[model samples]
Target: MAERCPYPFPRPTALGIPERLTGIHDEPLVPVVLPSGDEAVLLTRYQDVRQVLTDDRLSRNLDRPDAARISRHNSMFQDPRINPDPPEHTRVRNLVASAFSAARVQRLEPRIHAETDELLDAMERSGGPVDLNEALAFPLPVRVICSLLGVPDEDVALFRHWTSAFLSVSHFPREEIRAAMTEMSRYIAEHISHRRAHPGDDLVSAMIRAHDDEGRLSEYELQWWCRLLLLVGYETTATQLGGGVAMLLSHPEQLRLLRADPALLPNAIEELLRWKLVGSSVSMLRYATDDIELEDCVIKKGTSIIPAADCANQDPDRFFDPRTFDITRSDNPHLTFSLGPHFCIGASLARAELRIATQALLTRFPNLRLAVPAEELKRQEGALLEGFTEIPVTW
Candidate 1:
C-alpha cells in the first residue's frame, strides 16, 4: 500500500473540478489524509458514494476518540448538538421535513421570487461591472432565509461574519471559530426564547411548537435545528445561485436555450446542481460500525469515509455526457445532495431558490454576462465549503 494522498484534492478555481478526482477511475476507494491530519478513504464513483450515503452502518458520530477530525481550525462538525441514532434521526428529520420541505417551501416561493427581484432591481440600477455575488447572490438567499427562519433581515452582515467562522476548515484560528460559534449559538438561543414568548409562523417558532406543544424535538435538537437551518439555508443556496449564473453566462448555448424556452428553468436548475462543485461540506465524515463489504473492497471497522458528491455527480456511468453542460438533459439523478437517510433535508428549498434566482436573472437581465473571465474569478481553492468570493457580472 502506498502512502495516502492529501484530501480535498484541490480544484483549480471556484468552478473547476479537481484533476485528482477526475483521475481516480481505477480506484473506487482511495486512501487520503484530511486537513486535520486524520486518515480517511475517498469514494468518487456514483455507486460507492450512494452506497455510503444509504448505508445505515456508516455513522456520523465524530465524538469518538478514533473518529477523524474533519477540520483542524473549525469544530462545528464536532458540536455535540444532535448525533442521534437512527430512530432519533428519523424523528428529528420528520419534524424538520414537515416544516422545511415541499409544502412550506411552496408557500415560501412567492417570497423567494420577490426577494430575488429586489436584488436584481438593485443590480440593474448599478448598470455594469458589479459583483453579482455581493449584490445579489449572497444577499437574496440571506434575506429569504432570514424571512423563513424569522431572524431580522437587517442582521445579514452579522450572519455573514458568523457563518464564515462556523464553516471554516482552516480559514480562522480555533479561538475565533469558537467565538463565532458561541455568539451565533447565543443569538439563536435568544431567538428561540423569544419565539417561545411570542410564537410566529416562522420555522424557529414551528420547531418551538414541535418541541413544546408536540413531542417531536428535544430542547437541544430544536435549537440545533434552527442553527443548522440558518447555516445551510443561505450559504449553500447562495453558492449554487452564484455558480448557476456563472455556468449559464459561460455556456452561451445553454443561456440561449433558457432564454428561448423559459420553461427549461426547472431542468436548468438540476443541470446546474449536477455540474458545479459549488461546495465541499456535503461530504460529511462517517465512521464504519463494522467491516462492510463493497464492490471495490471491504471497508474495515472504525474507518472514516468521505463520499465526494461533486465527483460522483460527474460520474460518466450515471450521467450521460457529464462534462458537457446540457440544460435539457432530463435524466439527472445527481447526488449533489447526499442520498437516502442522511440526505439534505433542505434539498427542496435549495432547488426552489435556484429556480427563482435563475428565472429572475433571465427576466431581468437577458444580456447578463461575466464581467471578468471565468478563470479570473476568485475563491479560496481549498476552503471547506468553496464558493466564488466574487462573481463579477454585467448586463
Candidate 2:
C-alpha cells in the first residue's frame, strides 16, 4: 500500500492558503488517499503542477481498465468532452466554445447587472441579518445560468439538489449520487427533446441545432454536455460569491480599500479567487499513460496524479508573500483555474458574475459586515469544494 496522508489538509483560521500545504511546498509530490480510497500523488510545486496538467502522458481517460479513479463513479459515464483526449476533446470543446466566449459573456452583462440589482432589492426589503448565501450568492448564478440554458425558474431547486449530489466526495452516499445523476440525465434528455420541438435562443437549443441540423454531436453527448454545464455553471460561481464576501468581510481593511476605489474590483476578484481556495486541493484525476520521471520521483504507469491548484497558486517562488492578500499586487498569474487545454470553459462567465456581484454588494450596502462573529462562521467540510456553508451579513 502507498503511504497516505489525509486528503484536504486543514486550512488556516484566517483567509489564506492551507498551512499544511505550505509546509510541504518544497516536496515535489505527496501521497494522499482519495475519498474513494484510491491512492494518488499530489503535486504541490507550481512547476510540477503545470507540467502534470499540460503533459500528454497524463491522461484524463479514466475508462481504461487500469485507469485510476477518484470515486466509484464510472469515468465512461462522465461527459465525453472532458474525459477523452485530443481530436475528440477538440471537437466537443470547439462546438461549445463560442457559446461561452468573451463576446457572448459581454453581451450578457446588462442582464447580469439587472439580476444583481433585483437580488439586492429583495435583500434590502428583508432588512437585517440575511444569509447572503441564500439571498444573493446562490440565486444570482443559478438565475443567470438557468436563463442561458433555458431551464425553467421552477426547476432551479431540483438542479441544485442534483448538482450538490454530483459534486460530493463522500458527503453523499454512492447510491444517492447515482440517483441524482440518473434524475439529472433523464431531465436533460427530456429537456433536449422539448428544445428540439420548441427551440429557443438558449444554449440547450443551440446544442440541439448542433446535433440535429449540423450533426456535430450525438444524442448522448448533448445530454452529458447539458448536465456538465448545469453543474459547473452555477456551483463554482455561487460558492465563490459566498466565499468572496466572507473573505472581504473578514479583512475590513481590504474591503475598505476595494470600496474606496471601485476600479480595484477586478484585481480584487483575482486575489480573492487565489486566496479563497474554493476549489479542491486537487484538479480532476489524471492517470499516467506510461512511466514518467519528475524532478524528484517516478510515477508508474496507471498511477493517479492530481495537480494541486490550491498549492501552486500559493507557491512563494511564483508570487511574493503569496499567502498575504494584496489585491493591488501586479502580475498575478494564479492557477485557480488549471492550465492547458482543459482550462475551465466557463471562466469568463464566472469572472463576469463575480465582478458584477462583488461591485453591486459593495456599492449598494456601504456598511456590509458579517452578522455572526468571524470565527463563528461554519466552514463546509468533507467535500471537494471548500467554502462556508452559511454567510450571514447585515448592511
- Which candidate comes out best when scored by TM-score? 1
Task: Give me the overall lDDT of model 1.
Answer: 0.80
TM-score of 1: 0.95
lDDT of 1 by residue, 46-128 (tens): 88888877788888867778889878776645666667548768887877777676888999999988888888888888877
RMSD of 1: 1.7
* Clash counts for the predictions, in order: 0, 0
Instruction: Extract clashing residue pairs from model 2.
Output: none
Instruction: Give lDDT tens digits, candidate 2, residues 1-395.
Output: 34788667766553445667766676777888776676787887887887777788888777666554555542323343455677777798888888789999999999899999999999999997899989999899999999999998888878778877877766777788888889988898888888888999899999899999999888778887898888778888888988888888988888888888888898999998887447565546788998877787777888888788877887888878887888887678777777787888889999999999999898899999999887777767655676578889998
